[model samples]
Target: MTESLTIVRDDLTGAATRGLIAAHLAGMLANTPVESVHALDLTELQHPSVRVYSAWVGGEIAAVGAFKTFDTDRAELKSMRVADAFLGRGWGRAMLGHLEREARDAGIRSLWLETGSGPDFVAARRLYESAGFSYCPPFGDYSLDPLSVFMTRDLDPASESAGR
Candidate 1:
């Protein structure tokens, strides 16, 4: 498909954008216990380390994703979701590419993420794996937990030999 989507920093002041994100998250966690999901709410998105992006297709919000820095050299992938209507239309992949670009721009050397091991998160885990993220020990405030699976991908552009 032609790349007709635009991904840019989210406009938190826009009610529609915020609503879309909240709806997506709510749908994603509808069946799981709140404690099992690690996604942040609107208030947490305002943190200094978090950079949120929204994807627009035909001027309508189609997807959203964020990168939250855990340290100078590391960041966590968070809140990645594409509206149901936009699924299989490449929005998720585009948003992911944008997050990686943002990570690189911020000089982040590694990207970490935590997703559930349940059926609800199967697609998410596959996406991360396809994007080159591999299983890793928990990082940041997270600890090893049977309910969670952590993954990480290193971004060392200077190391040309490193696989993308």
Candidate 2:
């Protein structure tokens, strides 16, 4: 935590970023059913609607996070992962706040995310909850599933209480 983190928009071509994303996908597939694994692949992360960012502590990639826009008002948080070496260092919360600022600055009004519903995801669930992301029914292209947990938060300051 002593090192400063610099978060930048990523092109997704760097090996560190790709490796972390691969790990994120592997974790998802290993923890959840294939049908309930909603994490985006490399190709999907490069889509025009998706924007990925990487947080670095000097030469080391601390974490990676992304969001996929659904029109102008809403977006889905995607691909958030802290490198194994950076775990327990508050990188997850830092990346989450960074992505929230990016989305809000770009005029996104609400943010949604789908994460695993299991023991492997307890920490993730806690992070989202602490950030005011309340549980919600599946949104967008998602459907109800036992292994999936959907949560959302409103970006507008006036509706912040409602989001919680």
Please name the candidate that would achieve the greatest TM-score relative to the true structure.
2
lDDT of each: 0.83, 0.91
Clash total of candidate 1: 0
Model 1: how far residue 28 lies from native, Å: 3.8
Tell me which residue pairs clash in candidate 1.
Answer: none
Q: Would you list the clashing residue pairs of candidate 2? A: none
lDDT of candidate 2 over 7-69, digit per residue (tens): 999999999999999999998888787888889999999999999999999999999999999
> Model 1: per-residue lDDT, tens digit, 62-103?
888999998788899998988877888877877887788778
Models 1 onward score TM values of 0.91, 0.94
